[model samples]
Target chain A: MLSIKNLHASVEGKEILKGINLEIKAGEVHAIMGPNGSGKSTLSQVLAGNDAFEVTSGSVTMNGENLLEKETEERARDGVFLAFQYPVEIPGVSNLQFMRTSVNAMRHHRGESEMNAAEFMKLAREVSKQVDLDPAFLKRGVNEGFSGGEKKRNEIMQALMLQPKLAILDETDSGLDIDALKVVSDGVNALRAEDRAILMVTHYQRLLDHIVPDFVHVLADGKIVKSGGRELALELEDRGYAWLGIKDDETAANSAN
Target chain B: MTTANKEVNELIKREYEHGFVTDIEVDTFEPGLSEDVITRLSEIKKEPQFMLEWRLKAYRRWLEMEEPDWAHLGYDRIDYNSVSYYSAPKRKEDMPQSLDEVDPELLKTYEKLGIPLHEHAKLAGVAVDAVFDSVSVATTFKEPLAKAGVIFCSISEAVRDYPELVQKYLGTVVPHTDNFFAGLNAAVFSDGTFVYVPKGVRCPMELSTYFRINAANTGQFERTLIIADEGSYVSYLEGCTAPMRDENQLHAAVVELVALDNAEIKYSTVQNWYPGDENGKGGIYNFVTKRAACIGKNSKVSWTQVETGSAITWKYPSCILRGEGSVGEFYSVALTHNHQQADTGTKMIHLGKNTTSTIISKGISAGKSSNVYRGLVKFGPRAEGARNFTECDSLLIGDQCGAHTFPYIESLNKSAIVEHEATTSKVSDEQMFLCRQRGIDMERAVSMIVNGFCKDVFKELPMEFAVEAGKLLEVSLEGSVG
Candidate 1:
């Protein structure tokens, strides 16, 4: 469903994602574990088409369609979702209104009829329950004055509503409490399907316990040093990436191979 | 229109929108300042002698005064003599008694401007006073307003019939010498709506004035004076729009409000004067002076405005809290798109003890436009226990546009509490992505986000105006984001 070939990326003239190569099929959960500044967030931003980051080399494709050429919104309509590490606070925009607009926009882009107010409210109600979000909060401004946990949960709820083909959760569990993490994971787990893929980016191995990954790739200094099963997260958790002794360039070569 | 046609038409249209007129039919006089024009305008209105003398005094004071340049705006020197002192729609010797008697073409023009005066005449609820150029075309609900002892009519008629009321309140809140435009409006304003809510009476319906500019190369100078007597309440709405022209038309208007002890006045404006075209050609230069005074104890006055037009808009509808425990509020949403420029905000002067004021301003700039929020909150020495809260936010749609907030806070009383908050930001791609990821397309996302950014001020508007404002923002920022 997704392919990245020698994905070299930089932000503000500094190289971050150094020749990253990855392949994922549908219905699979992939976890990318990296140390601080290992380009974990940068990779997510680059994939989501953040203008700040420049892709210096390589190509990315989703379902055989070139992704880099598409605008951020176009990429999103084509079924790509990125859960931000820090959710933006839009003061005057209500969460529910934002959700409805997004859902209808995506539907419109797919050449489908737009949803009426009643239909949108119905979907919002259902999704709110799935993410354990209170309906009242939906009427509040988008992420304005929201707690960290609420922001993460709202992102999950949005993802659940959009039902994207590829869901990239970047540090979704970073600031969430145990309860919020559980709710978010449950929402993500419910979204798992045969034709969908999940890319979980995290520093801690704890999230892996909730949403177990089929493939765990350890990223260090902008490259993936090792790739293994769920046990790899446990190994990295027990003994940090120092034991690997693999620099970022070596990891890129290994992943390319 | 197709994009190509729009482009071609826009070029031809641009020249006319901003071109200077040379041979337009205009009634003019000599360049120097004088009381003669004031007397002539009053005589044309057939106003009483006292009103004529009032104008004479104001005109004399205006000559001694200097044009105000303190406002955060810039413009070339105005050729005062070149401007006509009065330019009314040619009316029959006899006044029109009904809608059918009025000029059908003029009525059609009003209809095209979205003000259905004929229907309003038939409707029982809404009352409208259609002011064209420099004269009142027709006033609806005259009898109904008269039944309540509420004198709602043209300022000219008020000078003739309700002389005492007009004399008691005119220029009391905002003196003629207050500013250059105010003095000019006081001197040469041909005619405008005059509303008087009697003491202890609640106005039965919303009072509205629709101002239109039709004659070529003529400035529209209208004066609006609304007085809500003690224990009275009234809501007055004003809307303005002009025909497409190439040369920059001048529209300098003055609106004054007086809220007596325990009285409340709410004034709202939706100004859509012809904004110059995309390349900043031909549109109205709207320089207006609107101010209100809370004179009696516990009196309240509020100003709400939605400015979405004009080539250069310079207006600051303000309030003066003179009575103890009086309240003043200003809520504004100014949008400048496609080469428009606006410098507007409000001022609240707290002079009485325990007075309070609140100001919320939201400015959106797109397409090389510039929007500014310049406000002042002042607390006098006797204004003990005064409090004020102000919030100004700007949303920049494109990098080429600019938004600025200049708030002046002065407190002479040590017990006063004043707080102000302002922020400027561009719509971020990341934020748009988050919305799109939720299924919102980029345009919808932009609209939703921008609306949210202005939700704080929108909530302050009346229900109907709030909805209209939301939709207006959407239309104003169309094609702003990709």
Candidate 2:
């Protein structure tokens, strides 16, 4: 459902993603695990077409359409969703209004009729229940004064509402307790469609234990150095990243030994 | 990215829609100001002798007063002598008894401004008094209002027909000697709306006035007065728009409202004067003075305004709560864009025991414009058990714009309670990116956030006006995003 060829990216004159090549087919779930500063987040941002990060040399295609040539909003309309690592807080815009505008924009792009307020509210309530988010939070400002877990659930609710073809989850498990982690996993598992693809990016193996992936790729120094099955996450967790001979700036190799 | 910013800029650079001029024969005075000019103005209006004396008194007082410079604004010195004191569309010597007798071109001008003078027009529930340039051309629904024992007419007509009521309330709340602009407005004010709700009578419909500046080089000085008698209630709306011009025009208006025992008055304004070009070349300089007085026990007054235009705006709508247990409210939203500058707010004075007041102000600044909020709350010695609450919030859209707050509070009553809150925020980069990532464009996102910030003030406006106010904010903030 998604394809990337030799993705090279940078931010403010500093290279971040050296060369990222990945491919995922329909109905498969892929997880990319890496240590800090390993370009896991950069890949998600690049796929979403964030203006802060420039693709120095690369091409991304979603559903056979050139995604990199589209604007940020156009890419979202084209069914590419990126759940942000740190969602922004907009003080004045309500979450319901935000969701309605997004849903209508996508529907308009697909030559479908816009959803009425009643239907929109009904869909919002139904999907929010799946993510364990209270309906009261929908009337509040977008992510304003929200806790980390609530924000993650809200992101998932948005993804469920849009029903994107490709969804990239960036650090969705961070700052969540065991209960929230379980709820988030349940929501993702419910959205497992035969024609959709999910790419999970995380630094730890804890999230994989709930929403296990079919294939695991270890990203080191901006490239996929190893590929294996779900067991690769357990191996990386038992033996720290130093066992892979990758020395970070901190060089905390001895502590792991 | 540069191309996207260019598209955003184009979206913001919308042209002023009501810039067309009407072709009609006009009666205008020469460019100058003098006692003889005021005498001629009163004589032309066929005012009572007392009215002539009042104008002369105001003219004498104005000559001795200097223009106040305390407001934070920059502009070339105004040439009072270079402005025509009066301009009116030529018509029958007598006032038009109905819309049919009014000049067709003048009626067409008002129609172009979205105000229909015919009684059976689309604006169903409201009665409008259309003021063109320097004189009132036509006032609709006067007969129905007269049937309700409500007196609604032009100030000039009231001077001739109901001299006693006009004499009793005129300038009582806002005296001519109040300030520089008030003095000038009193000296040369031509015509505006006058409304009076009789004792125990509720006005049947909303009363409104639409002021338009059409003649070139003419200064519009409007005088408005409304009085709600005992056990009465009324809602009055004021709206204004001017034609585009290269040279800056002057608009100095004075509005005074009075509420008597157990009476209530709600006054709202939507001001859309010509706010010069994007480069700040020429526009209207709007300096207005508006105040309300609660003169009897249990009286109430509220002021809701949306100010969006004018190159340099200096205004303060205030309230004097002099009646025991009286209430006052002020809700305002002021926006400045493309080199516009505005310094506006309200003043609340508690003079009687248990008087209460609430003030909510929202200011938005975009482009290179500057928006300032200056408010004052005072509690007199006899204002025992009085209370005041104030909230001032500002939103900035671009780096080149500016927002400022100046609040002054003074209390002499030991038992009085006063509270103030202020906050400043911006359209953060993170917020913009989040909206864009959610499939919304830059302009729509900025406008939505701005309208949300101003929701409190917008809710205070009348239902139809609230919608217009929201659209006005969106149009004014165009070209402000990247």
Q: Clash totals for all models, in order?
A: 12, 2
Model 1 ranges off by over 4 Å = A247-257, B1-40, B120-124, B337-340, B366-370, B397-404, B439-442
Error (Å) of candidate 1 at residue B242 is: 2.3
Candidate 2, residues B272-351: lDDT per residue as tens digits? 99999888977899999999999989899999999999999999999999999999999999999888999999999999
DockQ score of each predicted structure, in the order shown: 0.37, 0.57
lDDT of 1 by residue, B1-482 (tens): 22112222222222222122222233443333456666777777888888877788778787788877765555677777766666665556535777777777777666665567785444346688988778888888888889998888988778888899889888887788888788878877888999999899999988889888777677788999999999999988887877778777889999999999999998888877888777787789999988999989999998988888788999988889999999999998898877888999999999999999999998988777889999999999999999999999898775667898889888899999998888887677557656654656556777787787777677766666678768766765556654
Q: What lDDT score goes with residue B96 in model 2?
A: 86
Misplaced by over 4 Å in model 2 are A247-257, B1-11
DockQ (model 1, Cα): 0.37
For candidate 1, the lDDT comes to: 0.82
- Docking band of candidate 2: medium
